[model samples]
Target: MTNPEYWYNTRTGEVEKGRQSAWTDVMGPYPTQEAARNALKTAAQRNENFDAAEEAWEDEWDDS
Candidate 1:
């Protein structure tokens, strides 16, 4: 199989192609290095979206 084109190293906050460390230290199969580097930001944005959606659902349920 082919190696990943990009990876985000959460431990060191670095983006690189190919393997750098074990799975425990990495987090990506992102299409580009820029995307890999922004992994945390992307995750935060998704988390915010999920939280907002949950809050909205709760509000709707409470209105019923």
Candidate 2:
């Protein structure tokens, strides 16, 4: 099993990802990508999408 990871958006404070037909960002930090996908949960929906654009980015930078 894969250790599920959650990403938070820094721009709109909404986590965004690709859904079936379009993108969505309703409830973030979803347990699984499939959950996020179903609700269309994505950072872009809140108009805060970007390349690795998330509060977690800082952590990634720190690790590097």
Q: Which candidate is the best by lDDT?
A: 1
Question: Which candidate gets the maximum TM-score versus the true structure?
Answer: 1
Tell me the alpha-carbon RMSD of every candidate: 2.0, 11.6
TM-score for each predicted model, relative to the true structure? 0.83, 0.24
Kindly list the per-residue Cα lDDT of model 2 for residues 1-64, writing each as its tens digit. Answer: 7556443444344444422222242355567655555434444555455444675797789899
Residue-level lDDT of model 1, residues 1-64, one tens digit each, is: 8646888998998997976778998887788888999999998999999999999999999999
Candidate 2 local lDDT, residue 36? 51
Give candidate 1 regions above 4 Å deviation: 1-4
lDDT computed for candidate 1: 0.88
Backbone collisions counted per model: 0, 11
lDDT of 2 at 64: 97
Q: What lDDT would each prediction earn against the true structure? A: 0.88, 0.48
